[model samples]
Target: MKLYTIDTGFFKLDGGAMFGVVPKSIWQRTNPADERNLCTWATRLLLIEDGKRLTLVDTGLGDKQDDKFFGHYFRHGDATLDNSLAQHGFHRDDITDVILTHLHFDHCGGAVIREGERLLPAFKNARFWSNEKHWNWALHPNPREKASFLKENILPIEESGQLAFLKEGDLFSPNVAMRYAYGHTESMMLPQISYKGKTILYMADLLPSVGHIPLPYVMSYDVRPLTTMEERQSYWQEIVDKEYILFLEHDPVHACCTLKQTDKGIRVAETFALENI
Candidate 1:
């Protein structure tokens, strides 16, 4: 099995919202914000090459939104989904699976693209994987999360007849298993991948960045912050015990890190790029 870090680029989000109740004095020390209090975050995706199957996990915000819509997020960076795939000697057509952690715009927007007046699946041959729970949540989004779950970014996969749901405890591949969490969104699937004699947990929004390792640093975007706290505590304990490498999706600086039990709680022990492993 081979893994590639597909960087779709960076966008900005309000630091205060990203950090939830954490004070700027605290979070700013790690994710320093710009003049507008927006911190740059990477919309990092993952590509898994295992013989016949090529799976792309989580497409970043695609370049389909209007300028007015994009101006709000301050999207900036050179990395693009197409170019990133090409760098790995692959193309969109080469992908066999699109495993979405959740259907938030930044996470799944690139799964579909606008061609003329029609919105369609970006990866023509890929089966888009999302859990049934998350699929329902995104389709009929609540008012708070409606903005993040754009219909244009979603619905297309189902319309294209390429959407598939992983049953609870289903194995996507031999080296990969799905773990579900609900703190960030309903039934967000975290891929636990065994590779190179190491376990890499794709830390979707469950742990957006290494800075969120301190337990209390939950995001305001989470539907249930308290649930997130509990989930993080349990997950971190296991991560520390087994020495799992966390593959971050939104961390602009760090790609991956392993946690160690600190006096306070679980904290990052060491950080490195995925390729270095």
Candidate 2:
């Protein structure tokens, strides 16, 4: 089995929104913001290749949205989903399974595309993976998260007759396991893969960046802030105890990090590229 980091691109988000109650003076040290108060974030995805079955963990924001819609987030980067896939000698059609952690626009938007007059699955032959709870939640999102669950980016996966809900003990491969986290969104699935004699967790918003290692550094977008703290505390300890390598999705600077329990608290023990492992 082999793994690769597919960097879709980068975008900017409000520093406050990304850091939640954490003040700019503190967060800006790790994730510095621009004069506009927006910080750069990477739309990083993970790809797993075990023989012929190629699974893509999460897709970044696609380019279907009009200029007016995209202007809000300021998506700017040299790498795209297609280009990134090709960089590692693959293509959209080669993907056999797509594991969408949640239906948030930034995470799953690139799964569908805009055809002349229709919205269609970008990976025409792949089965799109999402949990039943999260699917229904996205379909009828609350007013607070409605903006994040865009219909054009979703809906089409089911319309394409290729959407599959994860079952009990869901396994993308023999070595990759699906773990659930609810603090960020309903039934969000984080892929825990056993690679290179180590367990790597693909942190999909549960832990966006290295700066979020602190328990209180939750994002404002999380539906349940208190729940997020509790979840983080539990996993933070387990991650350190098990010495899991965390593959960060939105961290603009770092690709992966290991944790250390120090007197100050849990902090990054090491940071390096996935290939280095």
Candidate 3:
């Protein structure tokens, strides 16, 4: 199986919110914010190729929102979903399965496109994958997360008759396994893919960047921050013990990294591109 890093550009989020209780004096060292206190983050997508099935894990924010709507996030950068796919000699139609980690706009906005007066599935030939719990959570979003789960970005997949759910033991492919985290959102699935003789865990908002490696660096956006801490603490040990390469989704600077157990705690050991493995 082959994996490709689909760079779908970058956007800005308030550094304080992203770091939760962590002080700016610390997080700013890794993810320095702009004058407005907004830090740049990449909506990095992953493409998995195993024979005829080309599964794309999380399409980044699409190019459908209006200027006024986009003014809030300040989306920038040249990388786009279509352009990134074309660079790999592929296209939207080439994707067979789209594994949405969760239905936040930045993660699933590109799953659907605005066509004329109607909303449509962006990947015409792909089956959009999301769990029932998260799908329902997004559909009837709570006040805190309502802004992130836009109806225009979701609902269209179910309306288009292309939505599918992955059960607890299901696999995206023969080499890929599924893991769930509830702190960030309800039943968020993290794809554990076996590739190049190593396991690459897609860190979809679970650990946004290396700055979040510490136990207390949780996000304020999470529904249950304490649950998030427990999940992270449980996973960090397995990640370090098994030596998993974390594929970060929002880390602007680093694409992949490994964790090492130090006296300080589980910290980033080494960093490199996916190809380096």
Candidate 4:
């Protein structure tokens, strides 16, 4: 099996919202904000090449949103989904699976594209994987999360007849298993991949960045902040016990990191690029 870091691009998000309850003095030290108080974040995706099955973990915030909509989140960068995939000598048509951690616009928006008046699945031959609970939550989104779950980005996969739900407790692949998390969103699937006798946990929104290692640094966007705190504590304990490599999704600076138990709690022991692993 081979893995590739597909960097779709970078975008800006309100730092205060990203780090819920954490003071600017604290979070700004790690993720410095711009003049507008927006912190730059990477919409980094992961690609898994297992023989003939090419799986893309998540899609970045797509380019289909209108200028007015995009102006809010300053999406800027040279890297694109197409170029990133091509760099690995592959194309959208070659992707066999798109495992979405959640249906948030930033995570699943690129799964569909607008062609003329019709919205279509970005990967023509890929089976879009999302859990049943998350699928339902996104389809009938609550008022708070309605803006993040765009109908255009979603619904198309189901309409295209390419949507599949992983059964609860189902192993995602030969070397990967699914762990359900609900703090960030309902039934968010974090892929626990076992490779070379080591586990690489795809830290979707459960732990967006190394800065979020502290149990209290939960995102404001999370529906259940207390649940997030509990989830992080349990997950971090397991990460330290197993020495899992955390693959960060939104961290602009670091790609992966290892955690060690400290007097305070679990903290990042070392940060390095995925290639170093």
User: Model 3 misses residue 249 by how many Å?
Assistant: 0.5
Where model 4 places Cα greater than 4 Å from the true spot, the runs are none
Give lDDT tens digits, candidate 2, residues 114-211. 88999999998799999898999999999889999999988889988999998648786789889888888888899999998999999999999999
Candidate 4 all-Cα RMSD: 0.7
Writing each residue's lDDT as its tens digit, candidate 1 over 1-277 gives 9999999889999999999999999999889999999999999999999999999999999988999999998888899999999999999999999999999999998999999999999999999999888999999999889999999988889999999999997999899999989888899999999999999999999998877889899999999999999999999999989989999999999999999987877788999999998
Task: Give lDDT per model, in order.
Answer: 0.93, 0.92, 0.93, 0.93
- Tens digit per residue, CA lDDT, model 4, 1-91: 8888999999999999999999999999999999999999999998988888999999989888899999999999899999999998999
Task: Name the regions of candidate 3 deviating beyond 4 angstroms.
Answer: none
What stretches of model 2 exceed 4 Å from their correct place? none
lDDT of 3 by residue, 141-216 (tens): 9999999999989878998899998888887678999999999999999999998888999999899998899989
Look at candidate 3 and give me any clashing residue pairs. none
**Model 2, 17: alpha-carbon shift in Å?**
0.7
- Predictions: Cα RMSD each: 0.7, 0.9, 0.8, 0.7
